[model samples]
Target: MSTTKWSIDTAHSEIGFKVKHMMFTNVSGNFEKFDASIETEGDDFTSAKFDFSGEIASINTGNADRDNHLRSGDFFDAEQFPTLTFKSTSFEKESESDYKLTGDLTLHGVTKSVKLDVEFGGLAKDPWGNTKTGLSATGKINRKDWGLNWNSALETGGVLVGEEVKLNIELQFIQQ
Candidate 1:
């Protein structure tokens, strides 16, 4: 089998997330700087190996003050941790266009196994002639799982920030 390498088309991809705030509303955020790579044997996604990293300093939640707080020691501690990463342990195809991806996610110096649901978007050739593929992945994780334990108790009986964080990733990769 021949090995195939793929590089992320950053311009067409996004690493985004959402979290419940005050037990009522959802706050969304995204990483402005990140990279990912994938390798497979002869275009077979089931044999894929994935690696990804997102810069903590590049986090954006629309509000600068909130973004800064997320980068502070109370949260990501961007100056110390700098980045969050993931390395896939398994890529199992559950159907023609669905997959189960299990990986080790490292954030704030803590590592844990996580699972994500992936939907294949098929392959296509861009206008520039680059062969590309797209994938959408979703999952949920507890911020405290990675040492992001800073929070406040709301006077109304709920916490300021919810424990669960929802992940929504859209990725496009070009064959290399």
Candidate 2:
């Protein structure tokens, strides 16, 4: 078995999330800058480790006002917490190409353990002769758990934002 190191292809990868807004609509956004590193021993990812970091100031939701609000003390508090990070503690193979990755996720000012449902898309050689790998992961977490509790109660019912935030990650990596 050969040992390999992989680096995330930022240009072809995305880190995004969606949350229920005003109890009726879904607001989604993506981080423009993030990177991850993976180390593994052959096909068995048991010994693999992962580290990822994202810039909080690069958030884009297609709306400037919303973006600013997200960056303020109401949500991410980007000025106080300049980055969000994740470091894998363990990875369990659920199937031939699926895994459950458990790790520490840090956001806002709190850190908590989270599990991500990961799908390994296998490996292939690109047209340019470079070997690459693909992966997709998703998870959900309650924003309130991370201390992001700003919200407004609607006159009719429900809150301005949902507590649960759905996270989605699509990644492509180049073998190094």
- The best candidate by lDDT is 1
Candidate 1 per-residue lDDT, tens place, 1-176, comes to: 99999999999999999999999999999999999999999788997999999999999999999999999999999999999999999999999999999999999999999999999988899999988999999999999999899999999898999999999999999999
Candidate 2: residue pairs that collide:
none
Tens-digit per-residue lDDT, 1-176, candidate 2? 78889999998899999999999899999999898989999745667788999999999999999999999998899999989999999988889899999999999979999999999898899999988988899999999999999999999988999999999999998988
User: For model 2, what is the alpha-carbon lDDT of residue 168?
Assistant: 95
lDDT of 1: 0.97
**C-alpha local distance difference test of each model:** 0.97, 0.91
Task: Count clashes in each candidate, considering only residues at least 3 apart in sequence or on different chains.
Answer: 0, 0
TM-score versus the correct structure, for each prediction:
0.99, 0.96
Best by TM-score: 1
